[model samples]
Target: MRYAVIILALLILVVGGFAPPVVADAGADTAAGLAAPAAQTAQLGQDDSAQTTIVVNVHSDTNATWKVRTRHSLRSSEDVRAFERLVDELQRGEANSSLDEGMFRNYAELAAESTGREMEIVDVSYNGTVTDDGTTGVLTMSFTWTNFAERTDDGGLRVGDAFTTPDGGTWFPWLAEGQQLVIETPESHEVQNSFSGIREGSVVATGPMDLREQPIYVVYEATPGPEPPDPLSLELVAGVGAMLLLVVAGVLYLRQQEETVPQSDTGPASGSVVDRSPDDLDGDDPDSGDSDGGDDVDLSLLSDEERVEYLLEQRGGRMRQADIVKQTGWSDAKVSQLLSAMADEERVNKLRIGRENLISLPNESHRTNGDE
Candidate 1:
């Protein structure tokens, strides 16, 4: 059974894609110039914080795909162009590669986009639309990417844009006050691993603004296919069935043996009379030598712990420890020691009230809080 359980656990690990953990350094340098001018950042901070919303939809198929939507409200017309410039600076990376694939793959497309005077985005499909109301500017952008998620060695899927440049710089939209981000995945998938900012039921993060930090990464496992039986569950079911079958077989065999065996003589044989002696009969004779009506039984052989346990069982399995000392005439120290011993053995439970310990048997569901 032990070997079977270990084997099943190994099979689960093979089929379940366990994601490895990661630790991020907050002080790590981020990509330079990703931040719009410090003045622009300050200017936006002076006003009411604008809301930035980002949503991601992950679809599982032969090639898993992600559709991301980023919506931002700008304070002025200048901010619209500023946002555009930032978007243009995003550049792209290699197709079918992960930000976590390695340090080299992390910046392949970023390096390519950085080389030339003209801005070019690679590895992902992206487009944007902007609208201005003469006071506030609204920019909405959508990005559809393949190869966004990589399958871990353990068969888990990892998704996110948490990447650093060759020079130890990070990539992400600058967070500002009151800005919130939400990433949604399918309910069928179980999110086994995530960063600190990723919450369950859907990843959501609110911020107080940091320009240099990257987004959180999410790793999850897709629902398994139905063809192969789950080894862990199969082992459990087989163990239970075997035990139940043994119990049923033993019962049937015992019944059959009892039916085939000869019957015992439960009554007196042929003509014999069962003698009844005088001591065997009960009567109120004067010289019976019954001390105290034979009611008192010596309990000196029982230990203090045994006596306490017996008292608790006789009184509906509960009593105050103080009362036990009164009834048994044991010292406070002796009662405390006996109750503690009984508690260790789980024969009785003890709870402290105002100044005394309450003792009761385990699993007394009808027991109430008040003292009797």
Candidate 2:
């Protein structure tokens, strides 16, 4: 339950985005009103352009580990055409965020400073769960950004649109009237982490998971950038044409390869495999259209007896569910059931390995006389 709470908080923080800001009416006047039209300011000195929006979504786990990200958007009604440098500036900033694998590293340092805590996460699971008990399942994450003033500041608080850290990357922007920009958390992830395990830190995630951009759009101000490229102009005709050509060529190549290459059907195939024959299969999804015959490794489809045999054979006498899922792309439900069955057979001992299950096999595969 503690783990669940941590995971939920993690979900909320990491699921970044912008919630719409309440635009202040232009008719509002100040205490010393003299040619001063008042709209809401992000801060005392900031202009109305500092207005921003924010959004977020969250989830949790049985194990006590989690993440939380923020997304934000900035809006202003300044004549967009006047700022021809806008596109270039945005691109440059995005490029900085990406170059040298800077995003995570930058955040890690910033977070460490913000919380006075070192940043560390273990075993970032490529796997996610939407449980049979729907209440506990994690899915459909999003974020909304409102005014920064929503959160009360007591002790020496900082405010405004440009949320910059000591690190050179300007983390957030100040916003303006009717101008809109979006930022969000990535929905999909498949990264190899140093903390997962030395023995198995190199498993490629199996499935067509989308690696998406996540943005947190709450509370920020915009810093001006270079001129935006003219959309109607023919300045980058050759560049755009080349990009399209590459995409077309890549698509054609993939189609040609897919036809010739007999690939294993991964994840939940759109249809089912009806092979009832006694041939042993490495991969056999009950709901898959195609089967590349047993070449695909699917531990979930194996019978309970087969699971025990495989665990004993590989781990000497015991095996963990993590081993199976890491080795084979079994879903979480299948992994849980498979592991429970192994425990019934007294094949492995389960232990806590950060946010995941760890299995330890017995030293001996075949027990001698009087062995339990």
Residue-by-residue lDDT tens digits, candidate 2, 1-372 = 322222222222222111111213424222222112222212112222222222221111101122221122223323122121222332343211111112234333444454344443333221113234322212112222112211113211112122224442234322223322322212221222211112231212111122122222222222235678787666588789989999999999997654333223323234633222222122443233243223445655655446445543543333345445543445567667766776677765555545765554543322322364
lDDT on C-alpha atoms for all candidate structures: 0.47, 0.32
Q: How big is the positional error of residue 250 in model 2, measured in Å on the Cα after superposition?
A: 33
Query: Which regions of candidate 1 are displaced past 4 Å?
Result: 1-48, 61-108, 111-137, 160-162, 186-188, 197-200, 209-215, 227-372
Clashing pairs in 1: 17-154, 30-169, 30-170, 31-169, 31-170
Model 1 per-residue lDDT tens digits across residues 1-372 = 322222222222122111111213323333221111234333322234234455565555313333333344566667666545444433342211111123223333443333321222233544444554644433333434344455666666676542323343444434445555565665456677665355666666665444356446677787676677789999999999999999999999988644333222212345754332332222333223344223343455455566665555545455677667655755688678878887888878887766766677775423453332
Q: Which stretches of candidate 2 lie above 4 Å from their native place?
A: 1-302, 315-320, 362-372
Candidate 1 lDDT: 0.47
Give the backbone clash total of model 1.
5
Cα misplacement distance, residue 152 of candidate 1 (Å) = 0.9
